[model samples]
Target: MKTAEYEIVRDFAAQREQVYAAWTRPERFARWFGPRMFTTPADRVVLDVRPGGAWQATLVGEEGFEVTLRGVYREIAGPGRLVFTTGDPDSPGDGPASVATLTLEECEGGTTMRFHQFGVNTDAEHAEQARAGWLEFFDRLAEHLAVQATSSKVSARP
Candidate 1:
């Protein structure tokens, strides 16, 4: 069976640890895990966040549809890199699960994140949609990080 893949490179105005925490911390992840019109509640997100550990998240759409994604962590190098396999448990026999890798590099001002996902069980068009969805998710992440930064600054005022 044919498969599709995509890679996205983005730079965030936050430290590598801050960006990495957004993915590993369940509370932070819940704030930006899904696309627009979808919410992933904190209680529904589980992140074991270690090699061989399992993680799962359920995003509920505005219209009440739910998408539950489950995965196992293949590698976890905190604040640097992460590798995992993700798939929808509801869809059995769709194809092989996709493997996703997130690499974070600390630059002069912030962090550069390289995200890649492969082995998607779909055509190019669907793969494009998936890529778009991930972009949306990242946009939300940026917004969340900005808010966190602002809050941290305000709290630091003495």
Candidate 2:
């Protein structure tokens, strides 16, 4: 049976490199990479941004539920594209692992990030929940990027 798939596109008022770094770098990733009700501590995230490199993170939810996510990078095309496979460590993989592709385009205002994931959970409800979670995560990411940009400007001032 084919699994559910989901896609989300978000535009940020930040450069492609800044957005890409926020996704690929461990410290930056942990800042905005989990569900809104969860916290992904920086020290609990391990990332390697190269082909075949592995990544793992532990998310602690507000209700005290903890989730561990693991993935491997399949490709990294600098500030434009990234492909990876991600899954919960405790879940049994009945079929193929979920593969995600992120494409970043530099636009006049900032960057547009297209996030697509295939072979996710088998149910539509799960996909919907995942989509909502991603939306929250992206909102947080945008805020983080905006703050970073402001800080950068402040630090650059003479």
Q: For residues 51-89, what per-residue lDDT tens digits would candidate 1 score against the true structure?
A: 989999999986789989888899999889999888732
Locate the minimum summed-lDDT window of 10 residues in model 2.
88-97
Model number with the top lDDT: 1
List the pairs of residues colliding in candidate 1.
none
Per-residue CA lDDT of model 2 for 1-158, tens digit only, reads: 44779899999999999999998888999999897778999998988989989899999987788998888889999899999888632254673357889999999899999999876445776667767878998999999999999999999999
Residue 56, candidate 1: C-alpha displacement in angstroms: 0.8
Separately for all candidates shown, the number of backbone clashes (residues 3 or more apart, or on different chains) is: 0, 0
Report the lDDT of model 2 for residue 114: 98
- In model 2, the Cα lDDT at residue 77 comes to 97
Candidate 1 residue runs with Cα over 4 Å from true position: 88-92
- Model 2, total clashes: 0
Give the C-alpha lDDT of model 1. Answer: 0.88
